[model samples]
Target: MATAPPPKSQHVGAAVAEKATSHVAQYSPDEKWAERSRKAMQDAITNPPADAYAGRSVKNTGNLAIAFRSLNEILVRNKVRQTVRMTERHEKKGTKRRRLQSERWRKQFSNEVRKKVQLVIKIRNRGA
Candidate 1:
């Protein structure tokens, strides 16, 4: 059997009305409410719209830092990948040959540190 939906109440009962009256009365002299209102007024005075800084000439400086970090990570990973590939290729030739190949890769990786430094300099110059 289907149950009928309960009808909505049309009346605001005396108890509910009394409670709401008390709440409004409490709000008048409430320190907490006054503090909240004060803070809200201060925020309205200070904060501009979210889009206020959207197209301004001011510098971000964050993007450049992120770019430099990402580039450094890519360069390091690529160096490692290439070294691994070369080492695998040399392994078929001989163990000593693989060791020599890895040493060459290590020397190549040493130069990558300079590239990371250059990237940082470029990022600092851009200021994003």
Candidate 2:
């Protein structure tokens, strides 16, 4: 007697379809929320605060440093050692002013402001 082929063994495609349908049941809203929260936290950590550049003088202090550097380059090109001494004197004056400011005063001044103040001193001295 020939046995009937085991009810044709449900199609392989049907087995895959059943698995896909059951997968929807396995989803947890809590897991999705946790994933989203983690992503948001990471994004926040990577981004700078909104006021990041508000106090930074991209023009003034930055330009002054560049000017000083270029001035040194010009002096080197001219083979003048005297301007280097002058640059050192200006830097020393700026450093002295910075050192003279009490810690309490420095705490009141932002870094950019402090840098601009020093830059001003360097400029006036350089001109003199």
Candidate 3:
């Protein structure tokens, strides 16, 4: 009698395993960075900046809008970064750090009409 062939699911599982292994080999360095980036991004998104950046907190929604607004801002920023990277010359590491630091400092609410609107809105309404 002839030997039986493996089941269909086993063949599919093996193919997935092989593909995952190949991707790992392709970018070994990205593995460690991926975890760190995920945690950092999660924290940053969870705790957003205050609404004082609007220059004045004339209308207070308790910062509930930051979580909503930041998502689109991040996407537009990503597109801007992609476009700038394609057009401009490569910038120095220090330049990138300085730019981010300046942004952080500028974003800090000044004494004038400073108010916070904490927005704790990330994945909402999980399955019942």
Candidate 4:
């Protein structure tokens, strides 16, 4: 006698599991950093402070240094605060060093944010 085919539910479940496994396998450290950097750049551009580049001519003085500093400070503070909140939510899970390291990473990430803002300023000035 011929054997019957597997159930439809089994096929669907296998396909779903394979898809989920493939997604997880496709993840890489580089992709993660790229996504994070893209997000930081977008955030920096979208929520620029009201006083960004204030009291200085972009063409002449090009107060990019001051603007970068201000933007970096804001970004770093926000990132650190977010990290702290997340750690608090997951309290008793991570070590103190892990928390400190996360804060340090957030601070370093702010430098990238500053660089992004500077690049935008340069492009805008060039276009003007």
Which scores better on lDDT, 1 or 3?
A: 1
Question: Per-residue CA lDDT of candidate 3, range 1-128, in tens?
Answer: 99887976679888888878986644466876998899999998987767634322334357858855765576575575576674688778899899879867777744222442222222233322
Question: lDDT: which candidate is best?
Answer: 4
TM-score of 1: 0.23
Which pairs clash (backbone N, Cα, C closer than 3 Å) in model 1?
Answer: none
On TM-score, the stronger of 1 and 4 is 4
Worst 10 residues of 2 by lDDT: 52-61
Candidate 3, residue 9: Cα displacement in angstroms equals 38
Instruction: List runs of model 2 lying over 4 Å from the truth.
Output: 1-26, 52-128
Q: Of the candidates shown, which would achieve the greatest TM-score relative to the real structure? A: 4
* Local lDDT at 3 for model 1: 75
Q: lDDT score, residue 104, model 4?
A: 97
Tell me the lDDT of model 4 at 68.
68
Across 1-128, the per-residue lDDT of candidate 2 in tens digits comes to 99665442566877788778985755499988998999999998987567833333234456788867766666566656864565675557767677658655776777779889999999999996
lDDT (Cα atoms) of all candidates against the true structure:
0.69, 0.69, 0.64, 0.75
Candidate 3's TM-score reads 0.23
Stretch of 10 with least lDDT, candidate 4: 52-61
Local error of candidate 4 at residue 90 (angstroms): 16
lDDT of 4 at 50: 62
Report RMSD (Å) for each prediction in the order shown: 20.2, 21.1, 20.7, 22.2
Clashes of each: 0, 0, 2, 0
